[model samples]
Target: MASNKPAPEAPSRFGSEYVDDFATRPATAFGTEYGADYATDYGTDRGSDFGNDFRADETGPERAWEEWNPTEESVRPVRGKHRVAKQRNGLARSSTVLGVGVIAAVGAGGMATAQSKPPVSISLPDSIADNLPDAKSLPGVGALFSGGSEAEAQEAVVASAPLTTAGITTAEAEQGSTDAGEALRARILQQAEQQQDAADAEVKAAAETAAAEKAAAEAKKQQDAAEAKIAAEKKKAAEEAAKKAEALRLAKLAASYAIPTSSYTITSTFGEAGSMWSSGYHTGLDFAAPTGTPIKAIHSGTVKSAGYSGSYGYRTVLELEDGTELWFCHQSSMDVSIGQRVTTGDTIGRVGATGNVTGPHLHLEVHTADGTGIDPMAWLRARGLTV
Candidate 1:
């Protein structure tokens, strides 16, 4: 926005700083107060009128020209100001550039075109064209001349004639520049809409692809969790079924076994420390009972031996099918003979106080096929029998 302030007067061609400056100074300074100084400088006498001195000396005005000579500092403007124009717009006035161009063209070329003639375009470099003055912004210029460049002014150069109207429709041609401008604007807007739609479609496709990948990842995570849970459940079920089958097998084995003695109480267990026997530790289980109490066979086995042993008094040995041996010691009598086959609960001996026995009691021992004695109680419990 240019300021609406008043412009200072421009320096004139005839050594005038302002057009009204002469009226502000003294009416006659040269012939009166400074007359002696000027006369001495020019070697002439001062007079009210310069008509005699001007004819006599050809150097009258030339001698006085030194006082009015403008220097760079004296003529420098305080601000941009002009009388005819409130603001500076270009290199020069619009009419001045146009008139100069036309005069130069006429002098160089003899040809001239009428209103019916096609337009003639003059091309200039960008440096020159950008600096051309605007005519529409001038003081008194009418709408006849546009403020645009020469290219824009081509159609208006001769409005009565048609120039470059090849692509225009009949309605736009008759209607004026307004309708032609609207048609060009419509095409530009349509192209912009198509570009916008293409960008929106690309964004939508990217969003859908990302959504599908997220959904697939979530589903895979759930499936893996479900498969792991099913595997854990199957492992637990198999372990429980194995436990149930083992219990059933042990129940059937318990039905085939029985305790060796009746009306007896446990008086000594295996692995007991005592000095009474020769081995220092008791190697057999003892059942305390009244004399003549019957001792039965624990399991189905053959009689390995039946005799009166030295410290054991009368004794009996039974051998099971799996090469395990059962010995009955401290017995008062033996009933099973050698080579006799007996089932569980068959009488094999009688409890007594013979053979270094404490009171009346039956001593029992169990061994593997190698004759190594083990705890009778534990061995009998393994076969599912109490006592």
Candidate 2:
């Protein structure tokens, strides 16, 4: 008879404590895209189940196997999505590897070109061309994606031969002794220096202008002062010339005239108020002297008369060309007759007590053409003769 009881599960070949494939293991595709580092982490997948899809490393020594329960995770089929056993997956992995290799090759070439290295061109033998027929026609992997100069980059696509994908940039390289940034910096410094030079020139021009203005101002001041001094000297010279001319005129007039009597005293003047004269005023200039004092012609004139009257004893009359008359009365004796032309300083008579007078004197009278009497002393003084 069999007992209706459950049988005990057999122990695993490795151990009893087992690891959950999905719980404890790091997730990894059997074939990852980077095929090179794929196996590097596989051995250390943190308690991975060897019985699962991961292939054990054949080159290293065998590692101890861990226990694995026959649960759904372990007994289920391993994910064959990226397995090399699957033809489609295998093709995809191969294509991915080729693309990564191409990208790496292009990156290395780009770095070398950036370092100013010479580009490397490729040559494929005819036998290798048939093996990689799609290499020249594929979109990203085609020769059009490869890099070179402008002419060469364009030519590479049309070229039947394959070329290396040396990563030259599409934009043209700048040609100069220095890069753009350094050149721009140099230009900025040059502009700054030019501005500084212009500023200096402006300052210099301003200084020169100021100096010129100052010099011009100084010259104007000097010129003004010189003009003033010259004007003052001219005025002084004119005044001095006028004074000299006046003195010469007076001297000439004095040379042409004479006094009426010499060594005589001026006892009476014209317009004197006295009781002795019948007209109540002295009408002539009186020159009192000794009885023998000689009387001279007052100026160059013709004597109109020389006579002895009742009160004016031995009187003489001198007439000028301009009708001015000089009467010499109270003369002791008359030397010139009427109409006698006489010169200045010629003796005409002598002093005497005449004209109902009290003493010896020569009485002289001056009258204009209308018989209007004037002061004899004033008339004589006007001709530069002092009596």
Q: In order, what lDDT does every prediction score? A: 0.68, 0.68
Query: Looking at model 2, which ten-residue stretch has the lowest summed lDDT?
Result: 108-117
lDDT of 2: 0.68
The most accurate candidate by TM-score is 1
**lDDT score, candidate 2, position 337:** 88
In model 2, which regions exceed 4 Å deviation?
Answer: 1-235, 278-280, 309-312
Report the lDDT tens digits of candidate 2 across residue range 173-277. 233323455555656897999999999999999999999999999999999999999999999999999878877876787887888888889999999899999
After aligning candidate 1 to the native by TM-score, how far in Å is the CA of 175 from where it should be? 21
Local error of candidate 1 at 364, Å?
0.9
Q: Quote each prediction's TM-score.
A: 0.47, 0.41
Clashing pairs in 1: none
Residue 125 accuracy (lDDT) in model 1: 100
lDDT of 1: 0.68
